[model samples]
Target: MGKDQDLLHAVKTEDLLTAQRLLQRPRPGKTKLLGTAKRVNVNFQDTDGLSPLHHAALSGNKELISLLLEAQATVDIKDQNGDSSTAL
Candidate 1:
């Protein structure tokens, strides 16, 4: 699978380490890591239109939720069923 697909899978399964690695870009050895330049889109939705935030929220994973939020996942994006992450 591609990086985007792997990222989505990591998020869906609540695999924090994999998700973090996918979201973080490796910097120059001495360069300080900055915010989200190479991070995956946290709001990417599946075929059903369910985003990572929606899955995280439904699974009650506060850590994953926070991570996705920090990555700028849109909480207001609705799924195929018209349910937003906040409403999940």
Candidate 2:
């Protein structure tokens, strides 16, 4: 429940394109409107203490894992149980 929560949702729902698009920041006519979605923080954790990278790893999405890594998602971030995405 935060500004960039959609980023987490996109990862959770397996919506790769939407996740990719949301990662893009809107520029001067070079991208689509993402509203607040454009300001998403790649490393932001949800209430469950799970970050997008965590979900991607849990879902076994290699493509999403690459995207998240490219976006600088912190791999060592722990979840509610102090588990990290080092599974990647």
Candidate 3:
């Protein structure tokens, strides 16, 4: 699956480990931590217009939500119903 699909799957299944892995990126030989993470498109919207942050919100996983936010996941990306993850 694509990174987007993987992110969504990780969110839906409440897989924090996988979600963290998705948000991370190796900088040549080093790695980017949450404080500096922004490699992946954590704001990417799915077919239904729900981003990974949106899914994380719905799932009520604080750790996942934190990770997404640190990765720069936009909180204002509206879904099909015109509601963002922050609304949850």
Candidate 4:
């Protein structure tokens, strides 16, 4: 497994706090961090193209979700498979 892949997994595991701290640290290149408490799409699921909001929802992270929404994450953004919005 690669480093980015591991980060994605951590995001999916609802480890937003860990992810946030990691994202705060500098990376070598482009991998810009969103700084939002969203989950990572490690597998890149089509239907679950879930951003941090999706992760927060599944984990009941209302606070994180609010923060991501404030950061302007599309509330209606669908996954790769067009599974409607993460709000669903």
The lDDT per prediction is 0.81, 0.85, 0.86, 0.53
The alpha-carbon deviation from the true structure for residue 80 of candidate 1, after best TM-score superposition, in angstroms, is: 0.6
Instruction: Count clashes in each candidate, considering only residues at least 3 apart in sequence or on different chains.
Output: 0, 0, 0, 3
For every model shown, what is its TM-score relative to the native structure?
Answer: 0.80, 0.80, 0.83, 0.47
lDDT of candidate 3 over 7-87, digit per residue (tens) = 888998999999888877665867656765445678888889999989988989899999988888899999999999989
After superposition, the stretches of candidate 1 with alpha carbons farther than 4 Å from their true spots are 26-39
RMSD of each: 4.1, 3.2, 5.0, 7.0
- Give the per-residue Cα lDDT of candidate 1 at 66: 87
Error of 4 at 77 (Å): 0.9
lDDT of 2 by residue, 26-64 (tens): 677575545543477999888889999999999999999
Please give, for residues 1-88, the per-residue lDDT of candidate 4 as tens digits: 4444554455567676765654443545656557533544322332347655555566776756655555455566566656534545
Task: Please estimate how well model 1 matches the true structure, expressed as its whole-model Cα lDDT.
Answer: 0.81
Off by over 4 Å in 2: 1-3, 28-38
- What is residue 24's positional error in candidate 3, in angstroms? 0.8
lDDT score, residue 28, model 2? Answer: 71
Writing each residue's lDDT as its tens digit, candidate 1 over 1-88 gives 6566677788788899998887765666756558535556777888999888888888898988888888788999999999898898
